[model samples]
Target chain A: MGSPAPERIVRFSGTVRLAHWLLASTFFVMLFTGMCLYLPALSRLVGRPTAKAWHLWSAIALLVGIAVLLLIGNRRSLTGVVRDADRLDQDDVAWLKGGPRRLFDHDDAPPQGRLNAGQKLNTMVMLGLMVVLAISGTLLWLGERDTTYRFGGSVLTHDLASLAIGFLVMGHLYLALVHPTTRHALRGMVVGDVDRAWAERNHATWAMSESVQSAERNA
Target chain B: MTANAPTPRPGGRPIGRAAFLGTVATGVGSIALLSRYSGSVQAAIQKVSAAVPGVNQIAPTAGWRIYTVADQMPTFNAATFKLKVSGHVANPVTLSWSEVDALATETQVTDFHCVTGWSVDKVHWEGFRARTLIDLVRPAGNARYVTFVSTEAPYVDQLTLAQFTAPGVMVAKKQDGVALKQEHGAPLRLVVPAMYGYKSVKWVGEIRFDAKRADGYWEQNGYDVDAFIGRSNGLTGS
Candidate 1:
């Protein structure tokens, strides 16, 4: 018999995948709503009627997505813990110095599990940013929440948060557009699959660990 | 997972053509119903009515929200606060707060709008009208714009001579029945109900009439310059 295709690599469960896309879609909506309010140039294009409606509605949608993610993915899995992901060991240091090219093509890089340390780090950063954005955005929206619960900070603080978010978005765009292996991450989200070769090479530890667990369960 | 699979991704839908058509039809129907049900006439009036721009002040009538920033008390010291009124004038003069305040007291009640959709109505503000200063300084005939410079460096706003002299425009020293709160704008602030809140420059220290117009901070950062208070008014400089 002809050799069968290798078994598909399932990186995320159905609930996890659903939450990811929901959150991702909500992020774009929230971004557009905030831009409409912040940038008069955009406000003019949307006009007040559409812009105000879009801001309020999209914000509500963003909240819903975040709530869904929190409900589904809030557990403290080993993956959720900060330590394993945040370490910028020698390989990461080297990759940073050489620039992103070495990290892509799965060339001359250290073995990583289901998610590489960098991917984990990115996830952590994204989570933290979303939390901050949600809280600060709420304060800005609701107007003058109790000073005791103040997230308005100073005008400078608000401006700095905006700049930081802008930088994070730029970094996200760079990784998605510039890096090949991480570029595959986008397709994974869209198609809900990653090639076995891609997964084994980039996330060998994770793929191997998952397979071993499956074998144990079957045996 | 393999790149190709017959199974749909999470949250993916079949989205048949019939369903798509149904969605479009529903959306159009809802819009039509909303247009018919909602007060389009009021919206039309809000657009084309000849009523004065600040006629409907929300702050006075509605209990809108206000956030207070910590006060930088006594922002202007007669010893330190010197207003340098220069540019396109025969003689440049720097007046102290006491000197400026001693000029004719001009109070105006006008609406204030932030680009972020918050509007305060009929805020009673008191200040020396720029018109009074314009009269005193006798800006050169070509001086067609006024630039407001604040102690908070790098924030600036420019106004055309016509808008600069608009009725109820003031270099406000007070707001809402009190000496202007520091967070609101203390020492001196510009209050123009007809424009967006950023146009109401806070902590204003200097007013310069310019022969040439200059871009304000918000304008450079992609906000409208002549931010008119009508619905559907696009955010672009005339």
Candidate 2:
């Protein structure tokens, strides 16, 4: 049909928004704190004492916060099933080819209600990164023991993971700050509200879902 | 240009510039607070000291059996191995596989703490006490620091002689009740439970003693050197 008015689009619920922001804030803290612990230049910026304390506490908080968010949020909506496994859906491929411009040209883009393909992909990648980091990190944290579980792979694996995670974080940061359409995405996290057009253009699938529709009707 | 590289702050200044004044203020405030509340500082020191790695938590049960070097097969051959210690030191000693293994033998049951924040109780590790090696070379009287260079490409750690010699610093060769698996330090590794896992440099290849301090791989990249558990070296302000 027609594009939903900016005021009409139902963005993430208050609880969902809260959970998202909590996780995001903790993630930022963990990133900075981790950097301080891993890289000397950042550590010098904060000074070792502060870096050490912030890194440890932030990590602990991030771990606990993410756990709570994982349980509280709707996991299914976050990770949609691939209806056709062996094939790349034409819709997704078209969106991928369109890149950033399509996201802004509302009419040309798919009717994404609450989350778009790009956002969905980011969410999944981030979730996987968190799990891998948490697991490997816990192993390294334990130090060398008689345990059977190995945390870091070879030194090369560990190095590569570090680089990968660093880049992932940079990507996450870029999405938040660089992309115009997604730039407002950060505001939704902070204030727990998104303009209707944002919800419609970015997360149509989520916005159109029964849960969201039902909530909007009830509201 | 990264998608998320930090952007300029609201005041038209860089994030670094914005953080500069605040960082200095925080630093001074912290120094004041630390001096005023010496107890906290002492507590921080104690907390870090205990976090050191190589404290074996899995106590040796009736079934546990310690193995000698001769009893086990060589997990890694010395032919291709090399230990290169470089950075802020008068003598950068690069030891061959044979040389590293030959240092006076010291063994201990110690724990390992990874930066991710986990601890393994106790495992037997065999190697030379880093201090003994330093004593032999007598790092110039000015050399007050030591850094462990890991064969692990791109990761290294600098340790103060005090931290290295605090106690139970063994270049690990054995773990649990058997020879160390290749996955572990294998041929040679450092086990200093007094610090975290990063401090226990694995696949160690070099030891550089110096009068000045330098950050290890993680420290240089984004980790704490003190790496004491429970207490943050204050890398994160809050």
TM-score of model 1 vs. true structure: 0.45
**For candidate 2, what is the DockQ-based docking class?**
incorrect
Q: Candidate 1, what DockQ?
A: 0.03
**TM-scores for candidates 1 onward, in order:** 0.45, 0.41
Interface RMSD of 2: 20.1
Candidate DockQ scores, in order: 0.03, 0.04
Point out where model 2 deviates above 4 Å: A1-8, A42-53, A67-90, A100-107, A144-159, A201-219, B1-238
For candidate 1, the chain B TM-score comes to: 0.68
What is each candidate's fraction of native interface contacts (fnat)?
0.01, 0.00
Clash count for each candidate, listed in order shown? 8, 77
lDDT of 2: 0.53
lDDT of 1: 0.58
C-alpha lDDT of residue A49 in model 1: 38
lDDT of candidate 1 at residue A62, scale 0 to 100: 63
